[model samples]
Target chain A: MVAISDLKKISEYEWEIPQSFRADMRVPVRFFVTRDLLEQALRDASLEQAVNAATLPGLVGHVTVMPDMHQGYGFPIGGVAATRYPQGVISPGAIGYDINCGVRLLGSQIEAEAAKPRLDVLATALNKYCPSGVGQGGALKLTERELDAICVEGAEWAKKRGYASDADLRRTEEGGRLEGADPAKVSPRAKQRGRPQIGTLGAGNHFIEVDVVEEIFDEEAAQVMGLHAGHLALQIHCGSRGFGHQICSDYVRAFQGAVKRYGIQLPDRELVCAPLDSPEGQDYLAAMRCAANYAFANRQLLAHWARQAFEETLAGGVKNWHLHQIYDIAHNMGKVEEHVVDGKKLKVCVHRKGATRAFGPGFPGLPAEYQKIGQPVLVPGSMGTASWVLVGTEGSMQRSFGSTCHGAGRTMSRSQAKKQIWGEDLRKELEGEGIHIRTGSLAGLAEEAPAAYKDVDAVVETVTGAGIARKVARLVPLVVVKG
Target chain B: MFTLTTTYQRNYKGSVTWGVGCDFQLEVLPFFVGIGKIRYTGKTMVTETGYREIEHTADWELEVWAPNLSSLLETAARGMYALAQMQLVDGERESREFEIPFGDRESLLVDFLAELLYLGEGEGLVMDEFSFTFDGNTLKVRAWGAPIKNQSKEIKAVTYHRLQIRETEFGLVVNLVFDV
Candidate 1:
């Protein structure tokens, strides 16, 4: 177990566990969390997992963990680790099973007061249009050839099918399509799973939430993103579904031997990895890109359907019901990029499991309008809580490798949450608070109760306090659809 | 030839019997059961194999114990089904058979459960009766079950996180984590 005494406090919201803490660790571990959050994190194995992640070969700088960190399977959920490109190792487990699991925020001009009456109808329409729940297939069933095309093209494939607009692609990370996706590297079983799940919002912490922008901290930044206080916005959170899961599983299993063949030793088997330049690593990277593209396209299709739902519910009843893309950012991914490390520029693969890429202003990737305002970072709170919209800072680029917290990380186990909270009663309580709820299973809702997660406001405060991210707006959920 | 009389109940602490080779009685208790201990009474005996859930913040972890690898896999499968709250409707029954190449004990366990997850999600099927045959380097399995009537939760994939099959004083013990 990792203790607070093992850490050297850098600031009020930052701490470091030096490499000397463990002989096997190649680099140190840096944490961006408040004292309270850090104390809470000590009760779990998240910090230990972060320390374990520091042992990956060719790790540069340090392993960075966000304030909303929680214990995940192999890697801590809010972890970000960057390794030297070409020779450094990349673990499939570090990127997570849900490749490119991300959040997409859509802003609209529809005022909360005007949309209040139709909120229930809008929620129902969103649920009806978006295919969700366990083992739920989407409307479109693609052929093998079509699936391959999607693997390579990503959200562009959706755009060709009239599911996305130009601005939507521009505002999305990597233009909604990651480069270097090779379908041939992906397994047939993965393709089979991907065929019918292209546009699905899979169960387990994935949701489509409608929120009202209650407060704006950065007025100019909010305006540039088309976010208006008291206006309606929608958030879609999901990932590559079974396709990514199979790809990750296949590689994690295959890498069990890869580690042996490469003669790399690690404390945990789940941290199995290979050199970034090795054939095995390249193959996994190629397959992982396919899943990432699939997820981008997945969110795009859902956004299209969400737009249709909005049109259906508020077409004639309200004026300006259009929902424009604010920003779409992936929280789980491995991206190859150039960053300054040890006073030198180096290309590295940044593996962010449950952390978002928060590129500061002046990066060329941002849309022209957002060049002065930095990349948008979406931090969704637990159900019936306040979600946040933030932007990257130079501090993030220098210290945390351009990453921030993903969401309000879970503090309680699912079983404990289920044992403590009744889903039906929680639903009644949320409805009483005027939040419309649509779900396939009440048990799932119970597991995701607000009490199960840390406070989102506090998580955001830590990041902003640490100067890694800047708050732009705060959103309060009005309707939540979970699967 | 063994006559397997299997009965599946959906009630809390549902019990099922897997009569394999001998007149064996099986029960699914709400909590973890001990390793197999043979107690003969005339011509009938009881076999114990069980799994229990472990606390994990973001995912599901299960600890299973059995007398052998095959029984451990079966108990883990049943435990996974129970975790998902899967229920099968009464109607026509279906049997499916498949083979998995034996690599290591942990890989085999993950592959077996992943195959079951694929079947449950892709074909809407769940297996109750399982027969295992271990060859030189492969595991052949024949399973019987029906379409799923309802499932309350979804498990995304079986993870290899801290997965190790151990030989204990009582039997073979293993811990599995599922990304839900």
Candidate 2:
């Protein structure tokens, strides 16, 4: 176990564990966290896992962990690592099982005061339109050929089918489609799983939330993002479902042998990896991209259904019920990009497991209107807590690998939460607070209790204080649909 | 009913004995470790295999133990089903038979569970009766169950994090972490 004495304090919001802490580590581990959050992280194995991640071969700079860090399977949640391109390795476990699991925010002009009366109807419509729960398939059953198309085309495929608009594509990360997605690389079993699960909000921490913009910190940035205080906004959180899970499982299993063949030694088997130049590495990357694209299309389809739900509930009753896309950002992904490392521009693969890419202002990838500002960073809180909207900063590019915290990380185990909190009681409490709740399983609700996670506001304060991200707006949930 | 007939007997403490006949086996050992501990009652009529949940902040961890690899696999499957709150409806029994090319013990364990997860999610099947035959470099499994009636949560994948099948004094013990 790592203690606070092992760390070198850099600032109030920053700390470092030097490479000397472990002989096997190739690089140091940098932490963007408040002292309180760091103490919370020490209570778990997250810091130790981050230390293990630092042992990956060909790692550049340092392994960066966000303030909302928690213990994940192999890699710590809220971890970011950049490896030298072409020769460096990519670990499937580092990118996570839910490939491209992300958040999409949609802003609308519908005022919360005017829509209060029909909030329940809107919640019901959202639940009815969006298929959720364990093993729930979406409305569309695509053929193998169409599934292949979705693999390559991503949200563009949805746009062609009238599920997305042009602006929706532009505002999404990587335009909601990752290039070089090869369906041939994905396993047949993965394709079979992907066929029916597209456009679904599968269970376990995935939710579609209706929120009212509670406060605006950056007025200009909020206006550019079409976010208005006291207005309604929707947040969709999900991923590629079983398709991605199977793909990740297939590769993780395959890489267990790859690590042996390449003679790469690691402390943890789950941190298995292959050199980017290897055939195994290339195939996994291709398959992973397919899953990422599938997720983009999945969220796009959900957004379309959410729009219909809004229209159905408030079409004639409200004047402007349209929900425009704010931004869709993926927290779990591996991308090949150029970044300044050691004052030199180097191409690297940034593996962000539970961290969002927070590219600073003037990055070429941002949409035209967001070029002056930065890419939007969506940090969802636990259910019934305040979610935040932040933007990238230049400090993020210099210190970290252009990444920020993903959400309010879990502090309590599911079993513990379930034991301590009752789902019925939580539901009644939230409903009493005027938050509409729709869910399939109350047990799942108990597992996701707000007490299970850290405070989101404190997490945001740490990041903004560290100058890695700037807060734009705060959102309070009014309706939450969980699977 | 899956008939279980006694095949072996043991009198030593901490020794594992098995009653095997039909699709399932009744494993008896002196003592069980981890979650639900089963004590030696001297009569050898109760199950010794068991699993229990461990505290993990972001995912599920299960500590499972049994007399052998086959019993360990079955117990782990039961633990996973319990974690997901999966229930099967009363109906005609369905069975699935398949072979997994064995690499290592850990890989085989993961592959076996992954296969079960696929079946549960894709085919809506949950197996309670399991028979395993280990040949040269291969594992043949026959599982019997009914269609799933309800499942509260979904486990995204079974992870290889710190997965090691250890030989204990009593039996085999392993810790499995699941991505939920």
Question: Residue A479 CA error for candidate 2 (Å)?
Answer: 0.4
Report residue B68 deviation for candidate 1 (angstroms): 1.0
In the range A1-483, model 2's lDDT, one tens digit per residue, is 899999999999999999999999999999988878988999999999999999999899999999999999889999999999989999999999999999999999999999999999999999999999999999999999999999999999999999999999999999999998899999999998899999999999999999999999999999999999999999999999999999999999999999999999998999999999899999999999999999999999999999999999999988999999999999999999899999999999999999999999999799999988899999999999999999999999998889999999999988778767778899999999999999998888888999999999999999999999999999999999999
Q: Chain B, candidate 1: TM?
A: 0.75
Model 1 chain A weakest lDDT span, ten residues long? A415-424
TM-score of each: 0.94, 0.94
Candidate 1 has which clashing residue pairs, if any?
none
In terms of DockQ, the best-performing candidate is 2
